[model samples]
Target: MFWEALGSAVLGLALAWAAVRRLPHRLPARAMVLPTGAAGALFGAFLTHSALGSAGLPVILVGALAVSAASLSLLLRPAEGLRRRSATA
Candidate 1:
């Protein structure tokens, strides 16, 4: 259980780091990275807990990581456009 949690955390951080790196220059605010990643981690953990029932640590970890990445990417994408529009306005 401890290892599973640790793995999930690491995966979340990695996903967050990747998202931060990939963010557009217009949206490259440090304030945006932490919250987005933290949200992704929490959501991934919750989804893993609900979907996998605690067993199958590997599957749970992968699923959580993927969901976190996807969620972060989807959430940030619209924000990029918004920031661009606001900047130009």
Candidate 2:
């Protein structure tokens, strides 16, 4: 369980770091992104573990990655001029 948690955290942080590096303009500040990723992964691990009951390490990691990516994706900023204008306006 300990190793699973540690691995999940590391994977999440790495995912966040890669996203920041790849899309610095799209993501919010590191302060918010880093924690979101970690928390998301941790929550994902717990959730998966509860649902699947230690199915396997790879499966748990996959679940963690999926949730972490989703959480980070929420922090992404939309491109300029991409907002849909009100049709009635």
Candidate 3:
């Protein structure tokens, strides 16, 4: 269990770091993104483990990645100079 958690966290941090590098303009500060990704992965692992207590580590890791990516995506913003078109069209 410990190894599974550690792996998930590492994966999540790596994913966040990659996002921070690739989408610097869309994502928020590193300070926020880093932790959000980690926490999200932890939460995902917990949830997945609870739901499938005997599931394999790979499954849990997949869950962690999916949730982490989703959480990170929440922090994204529209590209520069793009205004809201749906609200005032």
Candidate 3, 17-87: lDDT as tens digits = 99999999999899999999999899889889999996999999999999999999999999978865797
- Candidate 1 per-residue C-alpha lDDT over 1-89 given as tens digits, one digit per residue, 9 for 90 to 100: 66766777778777777667776553446566656665676667668778778758887777777777776666554554464545557
Best by lDDT: 3
N/CA/C clash count, model 3: 0
Better of 2 and 3 by TM-score: 2
The candidate scoring highest on TM-score is 2
Expressed as tens digits, the lDDT of each residue in 62-83 for candidate 2 is 9999999999999999977687
Query: Which is the better candidate, 1 or 3, if ranked by lDDT?
Result: 3
Whole-model lDDT values for every prediction: 0.68, 0.90, 0.92
lDDT of model 1, residue 19: 63
lDDT (Cα) of model 3: 0.92
Q: Arrange candidates by TM-score, descending.
A: 2, 3, 1
lDDT head-to-head 1 vs 2, winner: 2
